[model samples]
Target: SNIDFNPVEDEDSSRILFEIKCHFNLVSEKNNDEYKLENRKLRFVYLSKLNDEVTDDKKLLDEIEKFYDNQGYPEDMNTFIEYMPQDSYTNCKILILRFHEFLNLEGEQLRLI
Candidate 1:
């Protein structure tokens, strides 16, 4: 995770960016079934901390919608965006994004996207 100031914003909006990548396998040795878990999906998650005042979920969704309206939605990647509720420990508003490549592409393609 890294914190950076947004130069385009007028106020002091410093955001923290966090990235997580992982892979999981569902194969089992004892339970032998016709269907096998041969493919393992790669998941990439990104979390961005928003301004402190954005405590409302509606406002957070609207903010992300505005961003998509201005910058346009991503084409190559299947993306899911949601607001992460404030945690008791950190109490920070965050935008979580999960991105996956389309057409059974390799995991590295997500990095390029």
Candidate 2:
């Protein structure tokens, strides 16, 4: 999992550019069938407008890093995003899910969505 919480704000306003590129699996836990456990690259992009109180983006990054470091990063999204010959897949089938579509979902709903 990689995080790019760089502060990129114009002179007009403060906007922190937070971007994280990580792996997410589309396979749901609710599926009791054979698990497809090999999607290593699900790229999710998220953009948001931060509040004005967020002046220091780097500090925010550090704080976030520390928090994640202590509590561990989010792991429910890890999935295979690409097909490589080494993975032993007979076909080239890649599944990708947009983060926006699953943003409002929670728990089992999020996984199923």
- Tell me how far candidate 1 lies from the true structure as C-alpha RMSD in angstroms: 15.9
C-alpha local distance difference test of each model: 0.30, 0.28
> Taking the tens digit of each residue's C-alpha lDDT, what string does model 2 give over 15-93?
1111111123324432412222221111121222211223455443343333223323444322221211233442222
lDDT string, candidate 1, 5-51, tens digits: 33222121111111111122224431423111111121121113332
Give me the runs in candidate 2 sitting further than 4 Å from their true place.
1-54, 76-113
Q: Count steric clashes of candidate 1.
A: 0
The C-alpha local distance difference test score for the whole of candidate 1 amounts to: 0.30
Candidate 1 structure, TM-score to reference: 0.27
Error of 1 at 81 (Å): 6.4
What is the Å distance of residue 10 in model 2 from its true position?
A: 34
- Could you tell me the lDDT of residue 106 within candidate 2? 31
- Model 2: lDDT of residue 77: 27
